[model samples]
Target: MTAADLALLDEEVTHCRACPRLVEWRERVAREKRAAFRDQTYWGRPVPGFGPADARILILGLAPAAHGANRTGRMFTGDRSGEVLYAALYRAGLATRPVSVSADDDLRLIGTRITAPVKCAPPANKPEPAERDNCAHWLRRELRDLAELKVVVTLGAFAWAAWWMALEPVYGVRPPTPRPRFGHGVVHQMPGLPAVLGSYHVSQQNTFTGRLTPAMLDDVFRQARSLAGEESRG
Candidate 1:
């Protein structure tokens, strides 16, 4: 609920070694070092959510990319996925810059936060269900701490499901029977909780294949702003 509390949680997330598999993978990648980034030091630890604690919108992703966030120590940064995502956020007036290149970059999110269900980057970009479960507590605590949260923009089916799962424990209410299906532009509202909006992840698979476009992503955030009662630009 407090800024200091969120900061403490973030620090705890970075030091976590809860799942052995994830711990090994993230560190291995950091030590091996990608060819292009060999000279740069890799974070090789859990990437905590970015943005202010009082943010009204939360953008949830699947997980960090081994060569992206795992290298930069910031969610959705240093990767093609971030390129697409941040650009769209800029178009929606939610981001101060359209590119997120490094953890120290001046880029900033306006009234929004970006995080992932799994804090560590898994091998092959796929995390086991056990790993996801192990990291669920972090997400739950983040949700409970974002006191002004009004909407969640889930970037894929995994994030959509994670949002639902994390909310029940925080709100002490179960999701409605027959949970809503996930798809681009889908919106579902739960009583006394922030509205959830679905969007195709900005991964290369989606953006390169035309499954997700800038305009589509822009519209999603536009809707999010409206849902949160924030002003929107054309």
Candidate 2:
């Protein structure tokens, strides 16, 4: 990412108050848990996309976690959800490190990038449709900036739907027949710039209960890497 792009992202994230409900909830979380994260300033602001701007594979997560990305200002950082995600990314050979504690940490992605449909941590982790719509601009801008994007891996049903809807315009065509469904290892080749892949979100419930195991999630990334012209070790 260039300095200009980073600066623009920083400006957008810092001043993002598009959704009042998310703003209030994020502020409350920061206030309530001040001591535990006193040294870490909450990026309770909108979370920005992380990793290479020219990434060929973009992973779309549902939203930021209350104490995860919201607290750390980075996508998929500082929480149980990220723990599951980073582990799978590492196993898939897309990530150098298997941990994402904070944005300042030295973690890196090779051909993949991570982002969310809703940038801010929503109340109860559920965002209203209007709030999601408000945040779509950021998603659109991010996708536009990814000039070499060839694949997108949506981490849940909601994220899958959001990306599918957004890409229709970009591709200038109707979605493919039997639209992609959400599963552990579902893949969709759309008539677009990038093929869309689906995977169950690596949330706490899915990870802890074995609904979405690390190996299963890693398989999705393996598919993504393959589509992006990278070899998959799995």
Task: Please name the candidate that would achieve the greatest lDDT relative to the true structure.
Answer: 1
lDDT (CA) per prediction:
0.93, 0.82
Question: Model 1 misses residue 219 by how many Å?
Answer: 0.7
- Candidate 2 per-residue C-alpha lDDT over 1-234 given as tens digits, one digit per residue, 9 for 90 to 100: 453684487468667898888989988887776577777667667788887876889999988888888899888899988988888888888889999898889999877888888898988889999999998878877777777888999888999888877875555667656766676677777544688888888888888999988778877877888898877434
TM-score, model 2 to reference: 0.91
Off by over 4 Å in 1: 232-234
Each model's TM-score, in the order given?
A: 0.98, 0.91
Model 1 lDDT per residue over 54-165, tens place: 8999999999999999999999999999999999889888899999999998999999999999999999989999999999999999999999999999999999999888
- Minimum summed lDDT over a 10-residue window in model 1 is located at 225-234
Q: After superposition, how far is residue 139 of candidate 1 from its true place, in Å?
A: 0.3
Give residue 187's lDDT in candidate 2 (0 to 100): 75
